[model samples]
Target: MATDPVTDWATDFDHTDDRWAADPFPIWDDLRSACPVARTERYGGAWLPTTHADVTAIANDSEHFTSRSVIVSGHRPPVELAPAGIAPPISADPPFHAASRRMLLPVFSPQRIAELEPSTRAYCNELLDGVRGRDVVDAAVDYAQHIPVRVIARMLGLPDEDGDRFRGFVEGVIEAVADPREERIETFLGLLHYLSPYIEARQADPQDDVISLLLASDIDGEPLDPLMVVRTIGLLLIAGIDTTWSAIGASIWHLAATPADRRRLVDEPALIPTAIEELLRAYAPVTMARLVKQDVTLAGCPMEAEDWVLLPFPAANRDPAFFDRADEVLLDRSPNRHAAFGLGMHRCAGSHLARMELRVALEEWLRAFPDFSLADGDAVRWSGGQVRGPRTPPVRVAP
Candidate 1:
């Protein structure tokens, strides 16, 4: 994906560009002051809202914006997919979104997520145990990337060995956002083919996992459509893996680079949770996309129907208008009102699960390796497109 260098951040912005993928904070900062709602011809005409006010307004406005296809690609999903979009709840709107969301709520509630802490911690430690004697390790590959994939797999009753296949699906859906449209569609179809059997098996013999839960669930006394169940499973597998791993990797990268932050966590493990919030604010991984339902003027910019509107929650989280010292990561920052999870109807349902993984990931990493730093600052690699974080964050683990 060799994209032309961004000549102007306001006029023609490409999220898949290497520059945005590497460090989008400065670009967002520059646009926030110059152009709050930047326009771009890429991705079949899209808008990037950098300010908190604009992002929140668009996220909360379902009438003007459609969640039909949350991922901004060269081609969007058909209009019929509205109400219950590609991946329910996250990509759904109004009437259908609530019921679809409620189905998974109990599984990710605070109590449920709390119950998984011990296992998540054990998994993190297990990852550390693999690299115990090594002087260097790719935290993203060796640790951060594995936790969520394993957890989500167990929850969905997918085999742990299928982690590699699941990661391939994640990369196809998320990292390859700028690929050819035909290729992208094929990737999605492949995911459906892979998941159909497992869904069928769950239907035959129900289990305690999410797939069985969804299979057993119904809307207004009607069983869910098989396709919808597969789509939801795909959603859990894809969305669940990339976002949290990115957050975990980026958090570890931050600690490795900034020793002060690392030491603080190593000494006062109590601050890990607070630090996780600030880290999520500073290095928010997910950015959602919405399709313009009708012609609308936002922040003096005219957006036509079917246009792509990128709700950059990460940008909104770092907006100066929204928070004091927004660019700086304050571990003890009180009243942190960040849109890292998102805002309004489409907020992440797995937020509690994400927090638990992140908190436990950091806590265990610190406990195992009290001190660590980047092996080579230039070696860090970030995934392109809406989801942003280090893909190869190699760090030197202390003895």
Candidate 2:
């Protein structure tokens, strides 16, 4: 049954409210119950669809919903994406989206990830070893944040030494509000410049790196435009970093707090897979946006062309309608079809890599410190907008 959205205060849903961003579950739970299809006039007028069914339906309906503008805050009227009219294949609609995905499929394939696992495990151990002797360490910065950037760097044939620079650019891209508009532009340009040489070199002399693979890949019987190649590389570099970082941080935050879950994962090693899935479901970090392509009714809400919808997958993962005891993180829960990575065509292409990093990361970390908890009197600080995660979750590592 359709209902008119509570228009008065609904538009004022403050995504930037610091207290709410730290723990948004209560607010989202209330909205899902009272006004699931709430409209927010902020971010140039957007509708936040915060239900499992609504988000899933909208994501799958590519004809009615366009992926052109996938962020709530940055979308403007006429629905524009960065580098105007140029979007990475991740946010592009089919058949080009499908084509771009095909190009990336082999790189993240299960077989390829298996080959990369030994190096990933070794890197995970190295990160932990560096923090082994510290009395207290920032779980987010010292450990979680470093792994993804280094891994992505290795795959792209970029110098692992420059992982810090890549991290800075990724932090900027996900938190657009945190930076001034011009700063965002500079970050984008800086990244484009950093990746330009690789693209050019790959075209001339192919190698095993992802840039080379993308250069060799074709679109509709023709090589992708130089601009597309550059944008795709930029997307991979930026998009690859913080997403898994957030998941890893959130998982450890829980483990540090929940003694039972930590011990179970340590003792019953077989439970790690389901535990990882539960962690992802409970702490899914990324929220994507879509431009309403045309007039369409979704979950009884009338969506017009040019209207923007914020698909909060994190909220969907916690929907009680879909899962039993939705709020609890049940490590062994079966039939867990969560939207942590997202749904449909725009689902994360780097999911395999993320899973491997998370599993190896947890395995290695738990092995290093058999017991750990959040540092006393140290409150976890989180960042909101686009992608959200703990920026500083200090932990008291035990011997």
lDDT top scorer: 1
Clashing pairs in 1: none
What range of 10 consecutive residues in model 1 has the weakest lDDT sum?
Answer: 1-10
Predicted candidate 1 versus true structure: per-residue lDDT over 72-102, tens digit per residue: 8888889998889998878998889999999
Root-mean-square deviation of every model: 0.9, 4.1
Local lDDT at 243 for model 2: 88
TM-score of each: 0.99, 0.93
Model-by-model lDDT, in order? 0.92, 0.81
Candidate 2: regions farther than 4 A off: 1-9, 75-85, 178-180
Provide the global lDDT of candidate 2 against the true structure. Answer: 0.81
Which pairs of residues collide in candidate 2? Answer: 70-289
